[model samples]
Target: MLIKSLPSTWDVEITQAVNGKEALDAYRAGKADVMFLDLTMPVMDGYEVLENIQKEGLNSFVIVVSADIQPLAQERVKKLGAMAFIKKPVNPDLIESALKQYGIAL
Candidate 1:
């Protein structure tokens, strides 16, 4: 769904990770410039991933996409250095707007 949400105007290569661990590994490998992360997953959760990223001083544009819409969750991710927190069941329009708002272009 996220792949479909991306704007047609921008060209990008998409890599899908099954879980947070895989996502973090891909990021470490320099495959992820922009990551759309879920808060829940097997192996490792989104919060841990964010913490690891912060701890390692890695740089990436992280936009957290999750069903957990609690204000605390949003605030936590923000404090952990996520650029944005997007609600689950993502809308294409919102994805586009977020990208533009964060200066994430091709």
Candidate 2:
């Protein structure tokens, strides 16, 4: 869905992570500019990854895309440095809306 949502006018290189741990490692290596994260996963969860990123001062914008969509979860992720919180089963419209909300033109 994310791939299908990529703006035609924008060009970007994507890095895929299989799990939370790999995601963290990729960020540590400065491989990500924007991250679409899942709250639940093996090894490390999104919360822990976000915490680690904050502590390490990783310069990346995070848009959490998770199945957990409770208000508490949303608030928690926002406080933990997530720029946006989006629910799972995402679509092109949702992706575009999120980008626009964050003032991303492309």
Candidate 3:
């Protein structure tokens, strides 16, 4: 749903993973520039994925879009190295802003 919300003008490629482990695997295999992560997946979960990414020192920017809207959850992901935390039913404006911060022109 969030991916569909990206503007038609944004020429970005997107990949999807059903669980945290696959997300990590795809991140490594795809050379993804950005990731839209969910916190509550089976197998590894978003926190573990963030940890692994940090351990790998990967440059992919992460924008966590989860239903866990608590301030603590937001802070935790940020501390764990997510670039930004936006609530579920993600705002396209926020997504654009996050990308822009990473110097992604749109």
Reference-based TM-score of each model: 0.95, 0.88, 0.91
Runs of candidate 1 exceeding 4 Å displacement? none
Clashes of each: 0, 0, 0
In candidate 2, position 66 carries an lDDT of: 89
lDDT tens readout by residue for model 1, 1-106: 7787789988888899999999999999999889998999999999999999999999968999999989999999999999888898888788889899978774
Model 3: lDDT to the true structure? 0.88
Q: How accurate is candidate 1 locally (lDDT)?
A: 0.91
Best by TM-score: 1
Q: In model 3, state the lDDT of residue 86.
A: 83
Q: In the order shown, what is each candidate's alpha-carbon RMSD?
A: 1.0, 1.6, 1.2
Q: What are the lDDT figures for the candidates, one per model?
A: 0.91, 0.86, 0.88
Candidate scoring better on lDDT of 1 and 3:
1
Candidate 2, 11-90: lDDT as tens digits? 66788887899999999988887888999989999999999999988886999998997899999999999998878777
- Name the best candidate (by lDDT): 1
